[model samples]
Target: MDSSKELIKTVDLLLEISSLLMVSGANTNRVNLSIDRFASALHCNTSCFISHKTIVMTVYEDNSTLSCTRVKNIPPYAINFSIISAISKASWTAVEEDWNIDQIAKEIEAIKKQKRYPKLVVLIAVSLAGAGFCNIFSGDYINMGVAFASTFIGLLIFQLTHREGYNVYLRIFSASLIASVLASLGIVFKLGANPETALATSILFLVPGVALINSFTDFLDNNIINGLVRYTTGLMTVLAIALGLFIAMLLFQ
Candidate 1:
C-alpha cells in the first residue's frame, strides 16, 4: 500500500512538471505524452488540471487523493517547479496565483521596438577595427584599411536595407555582398601597402559566425531541420558574397 501511494505521488509530480513546461511555449503534445507515460508507469489514472493557461494534476491512491496545485502562474511556477520537481514528487505543490499573459506580451512588444540598428552598427565597426589592428600587427597595414572600409560599407548597407523593411535574409546577403565587393576593389586597385592584407581584413565583415553558432546550437538541441536550414542559409550568404566579388573583379578587369 505504501509503495502504491509513492507511485501515485510520482505520477502527480510528472504531470505538474509537464503543465509548467506547456505554459512556457514548449511543445504541448510532447509534454502531455510524457505525463501520460509517467502515469502509466505508476499504474494510476491521471488527468491534466488546466486553468486559463496553467496545468495541474490530481492523483488518486487507495481512495485518497494528492493534488499538485501549489505552483501557480505559468512563469514563476515553471521556474520553481524546475528547481524542486526532481526530488520526492510528494512535496510538489502549485501556487495559487495567475500569470499575467497580457503584460508579458506587452513587454515583449516593447523590447522588439527598441532601437537596435545604431547599436548593431557600432558593434560591427568596433569588431572590424579590432580585426584591422590585428592585421596591422602582423605587418599587413593595407589589409587593415581594406578590412575597415569593408566593415563600414557593410554596416551602411545593412542599415539602409533594414530600414527599408527588406527581408532579413536579403538584407544580410546584400550587406555581405557589398562588403566583399569593397574588399575585392581594394585588391583590384592595388590600394594601400598590401592588397592581400587589406582583402583578408575586409572579408571578416562577410563571415556569418553568429548564424553558424546558432545553427550548431539548434542542431545539438535536436532541432535538426531548423539547424540544417539555418546552416545552409548562412553558407549561401557566404557564397553570395564570394560570387559578388568574382563578378565585380571580372567586370573591372
Candidate 2:
C-alpha cells in the first residue's frame, strides 16, 4: 500500500486504541504512551491531543508533508481494567513483533471481546465489599447484613439504568438514593447495633474511586488539563451521591 493510505490506516488505529484506553479508565499519559508505541511499530510518527470527550490525532512519515488528521469523539466512560491491561500488553507485543496494522487491529478486537464477570457475581462481590466496609466501621453482623442488602439493590438499579442508557449521574443518583433509603430501614426497625454506619456505608459502592485516582495520576504525570477534567467529573459524581444521600436522610427524618 502507498504511504498516504498507510498513514491514514495508522492514524485510525491510533485513534481506536487511544479511545479504548480513555474510556476504560486509563490515564492520559498511558494513552499517549500506547499511541507512541503503536506508531513506532508501524514506522509512523504521530501527535495527539487527548481529552475526556475526544482525541485529535495526526499521523505522517518522517520528512514527508503527507499526513492525516482526525478527531474522534470518545465513548462513555467506564472502568474496565481488563481492557486497559490487555491493550497495554498488546502495544508492547506490537513493538516486539513489529506488527502491521492488521495484526494490531486483530489483537485489539480480541481484547474487546474478552468476557467480563457475570452480573450476579459482580453484584454479590460489590455488596460484600459494602458489608466489609460496615464491619470496618465497627458495625456488627446485623449492620453488615443491612449494608449488603442495600448495596445489592442499589447496584441492581444502577445496572438497569445503565442498560437503558440513562445519563451517568442520574444512574448514580438513583442508585445512591435507593441504597441509602434501604439502609435507613435498618434504623427505623432498630435492626442493627450500628444502623447509622450501615446507612453511611451502603452507598460506598458508588464512589468514583477510579476516576479520582486517575485524576491525581494525570496531575502527577503533568497532564494538567485532562487531570482537571477528570477531577471535575469526580467532584460532580460525589455531589450527585451526596445529594441522593441527603434526600434519603430527609425522608427518614
Candidate 3:
C-alpha cells in the first residue's frame, strides 16, 4: 500500500497525536493546525472535530471506499512548551518525509522520554521567581527573603501532591495554605517592613498564568466554550488561593 494510503488506514494514530498535542498546551488553534499538517503531509482528506476534552478524526483514501475514524479522550495536563514544540517539529519533519506510522509513534515516545531539568534547579527557579515578583512590587529585602523561603517550601509541598496526582484543587489549597503560613510568619513576628507583600508574593509562583493567557487567546480565536471553561478553572484556583490566605491570616493574627 502507498505511504499516503497507510496514513488513511491509521486514523487512530493521528487522533493520538492530536490528543497528545493538546495535552502539551498547544491551544485549540495550534492543535487543529498541527493535525491538519499531519494529514495533509500524507496527501489524505481528513476531518477533525476537537473540544476541550476530546478529539474525533476521520481520514479518507482517494477511492472514498477506504477510511477510518477515531475518538480520543484527553486528560488535563500542565502547560509544557517544550513538549508542544517538539511535537510540532516532529509533525513538520514527517511532512517533509515519507514517514510511516511506526516512525511517527517512535518520535513521540522519544520526546516523551526526554530528560527534564533537574529537580533542584526547578525548585530554585520557583523560589527565585517568587522573590523576583516581590522585588518588582517594591517589597523590602526582608519581605523578599520571606517570600523566597515560603515559595520554595510551598512548591516542595505542592510537588508532593503532584507526585500522588490526586485532588488537584485540594492540592492547590493545601500548598497555598502552607505557603501562606510561612509567609505570614513575618507579620506574626513583626519582622518585615511589609509582611503583606511577603504573604501575597509567596504564592505568586503558583498562579495559573498559562491557563489564563491561553483561555483569553482561545476566546479571541472563537473557541468560546473552551475559553470559558479554562477561564473558570483559573478563577477557581484564584479563589482557592484566597481562601488559603484568609485562613492563614485568621490563625496567624
Candidate 4:
C-alpha cells in the first residue's frame, strides 16, 4: 500500500486504541504511552491529544513526509481495568513480535470482548467492600450486615439505571439515596450500635476515587486541561452523592 494510505490506516487504528483506553479508565499518561508503543512497533510516529470527550491524533511515517490526522469522539466512560491491562500487554507484544496492524487490531478486539466477572459475584464483592468500610469505621456486626445489604441493593439499582441509559449523575444519585435510606432502617429500629457508621459508609462504593487520582496524576504530568476536566467531573459526582444523602436524611428524619 502507498505511504499515505498506510498512515491513514495506522491513525484509524490508533484512534480505536485511544478510544478503548479512554473509556476503560486509563490515565492520560498511560494512554499516551500505549499509543507511542504501538506507533513505534509499526514504524510510525504519533501525536495524540486526549480531552474529556475527544481524541485528536496525527500519524507520520516515511521521514514525516506522509501523515494523517483523525478526531474521534470518546464514548461513555466505564471502569474496566482488565481491558487496560490487556491492551498494555498487547502493545508490548506488538513490539516484540513485530505484529502488523491486522494482528494488533485482532488482539485489541479480543481484549475489548473479554468476559467480566459474573454479575452476582460482582455485586457480592462490591457489597463486601462497603461492609468492610463500615467495619473499618468501627461499626459492629449489625452495622456491617446493614451496609452489605444496602450496598448490594444500591448497586443493583445502579446497574439497572445504567442499562436504561440514565444520566451518570442521576444513576449515582439514585443509588446513593436508596443505599442511605436502607442503611437508615438500622437507626430506625435501633438494630446496631453504629447505624450512623453504616449510613456514612453505605455510599462509599460510589466514590470516584480513580477519577480523582487520575486528575492529580495528569496535573503532575503537565496535562493541565485533561486534569481540570477529570477533577471537575469527580467533584460533581461527589456533589451528586452528597445531594442524595442529604435528601435521604430529610426523608428518614
Q: Give the worst 10-residue stretch by lDDT in candidate 1.
A: 90-99
Off by over 4 Å in 1: 1-99, 117-139, 166-174
The candidate, 1 or 3, that scores higher on TM-score is 3
Task: List ranges where model 3 is wrong by over 4 Å.
Answer: 1-9
For candidate 2, write residues 178-202 as lDDT tens digits: 9999999999999878899999999
- lDDT by residue (220-244, candidate 3, tens digit) is 9998987897899899999988888
Number of clashing pairs per prediction, in order: 11, 0, 0, 0
Q: Which stretches of candidate 2 lie over 4 Å from their true place?
A: none
Best lDDT goes to which candidate? 2
| Candidate ranking (lDDT, best to worst) | 2, 4, 3, 1
Question: Which should have the higher lDDT, number 1 or number 4?
Answer: 4
Give per-model CA RMSD: 11.7, 1.1, 2.2, 1.1
**Candidate 4 local lDDT, 1-253, one digit each (tens):** 5867877888999999989998988889999999999998998888877998999998887666667989999989998999999999999999999999989988988898899999999999999999999999999999999999999999999999988999999999999999999998988998789899999999999999999999999999999999999999999999999999999999989
Model 2 Cα shift for residue 79 (angstroms): 1.2
> How accurate locally is residue 133 in candidate 2, as Cα lDDT from 0 to 100?
99
lDDT to native, each model: 0.54, 0.93, 0.84, 0.93
Candidate 4, poorest ten consecutive residues by summed lDDT = 58-67
Q: Per-residue error at 224 for model 1, in Å?
A: 1.3
